[model samples]
Target: MSHAAALTLPFDTDTILEGLKSWAACESPTFDAAAVNRMMDIAGRELALLGANIDRIPGRLGLGDCVRARFPHPSGETTAGILILAHLDTVHPIGTLEKLPIRVEGPLCYGPGICDMKGGTYIAVEAIRQLLRAKVATPLPITVLLTCDEEIGSPSTRDLIEAEAARARYVLVPEPARPDGGVVTGRYAIARFNLRATGKPSHAGSRLGEGRSAIREICRQTLAIEEMTTEDCTFSVGVIHGGQWVNCVATHCDAEALSMAKRQEDLDAGVAKMLGLRATGNDVSLEVKRGVTRPVWEPDAGVMALYDKARYIANAIGFDIAHQSSGGGSDGNFTGAMGVPTLDGLGVSGAKMHTLEEHIEIASLVPRARLIAGLLTTLGA
Candidate 1:
């Protein structure tokens, strides 16, 4: 198919927006297995309608199951394929739809998960749909894997994503495009950690000196962790839970923290500093546990090749494209780190992700979807 033809597909804006609204209304939070399962069912059914062979991978360890869809090459060449990596889960909890309902204000669509990924997910679907309608034939197979727990670091789906990426020749992550219209060619290394402090509890009025305050210990540690930030590595304590009452000294405090680094050495150094944090008081004890450790996705020759193709398509469609390294983690991080060529941030252009004000540019829907279709057609050729 010609690039011009691919960019001019009769993508019905109303139809695409309606589809996004439907998916966004489902509220598939990462922690809610049942809700995410429902989302997987919806996505699976849609993919099946598009003639894909669907496989419902079961959930594990309290996460919702993943849905895998395969579109075999028309010519029977299946040794290599294109992998479309995405997630259906959102950070918004259930009942967010009422407050952040899907609405269109001029060129933007507002809703929970719309900008972050739901928009991107639908973009992938429509891209393939348009490709099929155009009757373009590709020699390489196409696969789409929509996992359940990406918002929480993709703990369960990492292995599945890597395994699929290992077989495919290219991996495309349809995350939302950057605010400045750049795609992602590299991603930072990230680590999740939880810090806890334990101390003696006593009434503040009755025994002030006798009791050691865990809250105080945690505050001290938080300050230290915050101070560990540098030009490359950054740390933030996102969550904290502690204290009982004003009249009593708290016995326990816990915090959820994460660190991001552009380079592996910086990440290692930052981790060492975080782990080496000492307790201010002798009576207070500290416990630090590491959670997910996502390796940095450094740019490579393969990525540059992919970008060359993408740039060609963007130029064909009358726009300029750019690339940047993001601090956020995606399944692309896993694949790219494993030496698989990966291109990310091919979704809609929007902002305020993970917030109630999240939204996407309505005008970007057709062009971005066409860009994806263009890439697929080029790869298959």
Candidate 2:
């Protein structure tokens, strides 16, 4: 039997589900520092139970703390090893569990933040736990880093991620698996822009002609901004806020937009176009400011080599996993772009991410855990 096949027997589906539900129950939204920390605390306790040396880095920029757990090696090899990257935060608010409670129905399990990432994060921890229980000694030591701000583009944790990855031989991110049970080897470049429209305010009773309504200007600009979408680059305005009262012409409006491209040059050109936007109406001003961005991660020979090993392991475990260049952004983008051999989307297989209906296939938990355990044992050996 293959090494992965041997590891599969130790991961019980029921045990994995119970542990995963605890993570999903915490509801650590990205903006809620305390909630995110609570999730971190749970993770930290689990790692401590495994006898791993843990380091808790205090959060910055109003974000939650990050946890780094280093597993001791039998041979005491302190050189570069595997880095398992994960995030505990989700997009769902604090009380999402009331609507989407954690429960198993047939082969599918449902909960808030269950599919998007909590499932994957918990599985990684479980993989380590099983490995320790089985007394398996890997060729290299392992480190797991769980951050708190990936959903919001990882503003505070990007530097920490890169630093960890720079010293590691390989990086694995357990973001939600691809819809077809595939893995991610590359990701599209993404950019965010903040937009503002300013115009003169006037009363609606009589001087309507004298006022240039910022709300109207912003509406016109939103259409134009969305019209910039094309095959190479896509743009969308996701958030807009304006006008306070019906009686007076609004003097200010604000909006936010997101752009994605397969190439860095294409994303840069799109950024330039967005920043070059000019107001069509006289005396009105429009401004576009760039926000957080994720660079494109093109698969290299090293990346493909890592994927090949994962594919081989999956096949041995009685399943197959394909690879693709995904659209959504993750911390993998940072490490992959830095030329680190990174494999992402190795989490639970599921659908309806970032929605109330998010869930994972109960059948996927054991096989996926086996896949991760196989890599931890065989890679670099």
In order of appearance, the predictions have TM-scores of: 0.96, 0.95
lDDT of 1 by residue, 1-381 (tens): 456667767787789889988999888999999999999999999999999999999999899999999986665535778999999999999999888988999888999999889999898899999878877765578999999998888889888999899888999999999888879999999998989999999989989988999988888888888888889899999989999798999999999999999999999988887887778878999999888889999989999899888889988887878999898898888999998889999999999999989999998888788888888878756
Q: For candidate 1, what is the TM-score?
A: 0.96
Task: Candidate 1: give the clashing pairs.
Answer: none
Report the lDDT tens digits of candidate 2 across residue range 1-381. Answer: 236434544789999999999889998999999999999999999999999899999999999999999988764645899999999999999999999999899999999999889999888888888888887777778999999999888989999999999989999998888988999999999999999999999997798888888988989998998999999999999888998988888999999999999999999999999999999888899988999899999999999999999999899888999999989899999999999999999999998898989999999999888888888888887
Off by over 4 Å in 2: 1-8, 75-77, 204-210
lDDT of each: 0.89, 0.91
Error of 1 at 184 (Å): 0.7
Clashing residue pairs found in predicted model 2: none
